[model samples]
Target: MSVSNEPTLKPERPFFSSGPTAKFPGWSLDKLKTESLGRSHRSKIGKARLKYAIDLSRELLGVPDDYLVGILPASDTGALECAMWTMLGPQPATVAAWESFGNVWIQDAVKQLKLKNLTALDADYGEIPDLASIPQDNDVVFTWNGTTSGARIPNTDWLESGRSGVTINDATSAIFAQEMDWPKLDATTYSWQKVMGSEAQHGMLILSPKAIERIESYDPDWPLPKLFRLKKGGKINQGIFEGATINTPSLLATEDYIAALEWAKSIGGRQAMFERANENARILEAWIEATPWISNMVSDPAKRTNTGVCMVFGGDWYESLSDEDKAGVPKKIVSMLEERGVGYDFNGYRDAPPSLRIWCGGTVDAEDVKRLLPWIEWAFEEVKASHAN
Candidate 1:
């Protein structure tokens, strides 16, 4: 492999990990000045700050008035457990496990909760199960986008409009980056650390009226953990949906989320955010089309996710290597990128095939992605030259 010239351009900000993604374009510690620190979250000003976050999120994301949006103690996982424990026992379950995150939900539904009636729909990395097979008669749980594999459901057309069952969506990496069909979703969960590029340690749970009605009317036989409780005295905890969180939240994170929401609103809200994300992805797509040595991990364009843009090494020379050596290529490429401070945490998820998983969320500028492309080729050539047999 002939090495290319060393690249001089680099992304202005190299914080591209999917979780704890890049913050708004000009974020700094000064942005936390408005944070309500040293005060109880139960205090008047504290609750107001929390409410501000929820209100801004609802407004910026175009959440309907009929739905309830709230902050939860755990990151996306905690909010998911709250939904499963509160709403799943009475309904027969159908889970779609396409990638690591979806598989986690399936494991929770089958092993952790020990549900008696379960139907699992599965697919390998970079693919999705047959979503049409999901029955409306039973609860269906799935991730909108497989963060690790970079696969996503193309749309919500498979969901029946007036179904009896509930739809639980883990949209941690999808929200903000993609347009959500709220009418098709009963329960949606995400963390601040994802698309919004805020700090973690908290989750956001959005429940449709039907989801609230389901949990308020029915109770699961299993004892709910303190973290998973959504009902009290045979009624839904309305306070939780109104900024009264289940546990204490990080004030700094709350303020940071609010700042991100403000930034989203400044840039024309959700629509603008979606366009920016898509534009960043387009930059990568153009690069992938031109580059012969790499290809998208997702073969199907429709199911591909824009944010977690995953790619694999290709070409005859690479394929001739043993599986072990093929796996080592991504590590070397990632190490080269990080060593040069051109990108960080660009390695694929552990459970997925070895590849580069670059974050292309709205917070990331398209120009930066353009700057990063040449460096990827430079890193690949450096690694290939060193590994020449």
Candidate 2:
């Protein structure tokens, strides 16, 4: 069946970028303006707000009680770096990297930290390494979901329950939206901007009791920047975990995050959020299954990510294009959708292969995602018609 160039239905809200994603369904500037602005973050009110964010984040994500959950400077990168610099040097490390963000961690471990006893397990995009192959005695670092590649570990069965080494996970796009195996994760980091759909620049770092012990016991030989320091005088800084952030934070962003957390609570918390994300992905999956012109980037259905649904064009139209033209097709399709005000930033990551990555996080409504699918088909047909001789 030929798709129409004119799609009657449009997404009710077209803000679908994977990062700095669509805010909570009823978000407004008023929700953010309630922040205690024009006051020091060190003040009682400011600290209380920060602490609220921390406490709410812990509650929403179901973090363990003994874990040290804190708001860190910068985004998810800062939180990962804070963990890496503080805890990685003492043990032989193994870094598993499949897509863009995970590769960055591997690079930092090998080139920047110049660790000698590091093993980097690399996989192609849309594929995952064998989690079972990682040594139990080695510190393991990996991304919980490869946002760009749209591949995620299906479960935590591969993780050793009584493992000796710590497992640090970069879960920026997976937290809240996905069920995490908290017991298997020693350190996990995420930005407020991804799953929660809050403003950027603030990261939530969740550390298990084991991770805290590593921080208090070991210090990196290389001098850590103030941003990466998690300890003071050979002890883990207890104050940072209690809302005393190492650097000044955006009060406005904090308020935005709190509003999001409240919205999350009103919607029944993590399980509800996870169901929303999965439902959104299911909408797109049904469309992909029926549509001959498109297919998911992930080869394994079980490994596919529910949040960032990356898809590539198929059939003769895509096959006829040269390598350079094929690389640009996804962009052309994105431009057509954007020109119609149907979608924004629907294009895949710059480093990933040509495809469209639709954000299917908790904040996105499944009906909106369903509405967007017909537009995608419409845009693809239009782009394909133009490219044909």
lDDT of each: 0.89, 0.90
Residue ranges of candidate 1 with Cα displaced over 4 Å: none
Off by over 4 Å in 2: 1-5, 33-35
Per-residue lDDT value at 103 in model 1: 88
What pairs collide in candidate 1? none
RMSD (Cα, Å) for all candidates, in order, is 1.3, 1.6
What's the TM-score of every candidate structure? 0.98, 0.98
Q: Please, what are the lDDT tens digits per residue for candidate 2 over residues 1-389? A: 34465878888899889998999998889767564898899999999999999999889888899999999998999999888888898889999999999999999999999988999998998899998888898999999999899999999887889788999999999998888899989999999999999999999889999999988888678999998888888888888999999999999889999999999999999999999999999988888999998889998999999999899878987888898989888898788788889999989999998899999999999888988887877777777777763
TM-score for predicted model 2 compared with the true structure: 0.98
- Lowest-scoring 10 consecutive residues by lDDT in candidate 1? 27-36
Task: Give the C-alpha miss distance for residue 20 in model 1, angstroms.
Answer: 1.4
- Candidate 2 residue 235 Cα shift, in angstroms, is 1.1
Query: What's the lDDT for candidate 2?
Result: 0.90
